[model samples]
Target: MPPASHDGDRDDDDGGSFIDMESFYASSGVSFVMVLLTIASVLYINPYWRRVWFYYVRITITSCYYFVVDHLPVPVKYKVLELRV
Candidate 1:
């Protein structure tokens, strides 16, 4: 592609010099896939890091569960506690 001419002869109706939407989305999708693959490969190669990652995930989920349970209304809490038994 020739360098975009700075000469003021370009038509204003052409919508100017912008990236193609389809190409932009395709590139973005490929980039995200590459990033996920890299992360998966790293985790697969390092068992200790994978375990640590899962540990953090478990802790985060447990914390969120307790937080939600603790904030429940008294009647709801009673029902939940009864269900636990």
Candidate 2:
């Protein structure tokens, strides 16, 4: 039998080079879930880690409070003072 002639058209072959989007999304979702699960497990199993997380959260809240209090405009501060009184 004679060999088939080569052509530039690629319509016959399935798309092997392209990434499967469904599989990619499924794997990404699974990875995200796993990471969250791991974090939750660690926080649940370790009291020290949980305490550290809370400490950071407390510090963040305190810093934000100070920033807002110190940087408020004069009129806003007066209004707050009026509300306080």
Candidate 2: regions farther than 4 A off:
1-17, 64-85
Candidate 1 TM-score to native: 0.60
CA lDDT, every model vs. true structure: 0.85, 0.86
- lDDT by residue (1-85, candidate 1, tens digit) is 8888676775554456487667789999999999999989999999999999999999999999999989866775456443553
Best by TM-score: 1
Clash count, candidate 1: 0
- For residues 11-74, write the lDDT of model 2, one tens digit per residue: 6554664777778899999999999999999999999999999999999999999999999766
How well does model 2 score by local distance difference test?
0.86
Candidate 1 segments whose C-alpha is farther than 4 A from its true place:
1-17, 72-85
Colliding pairs, model 1: none
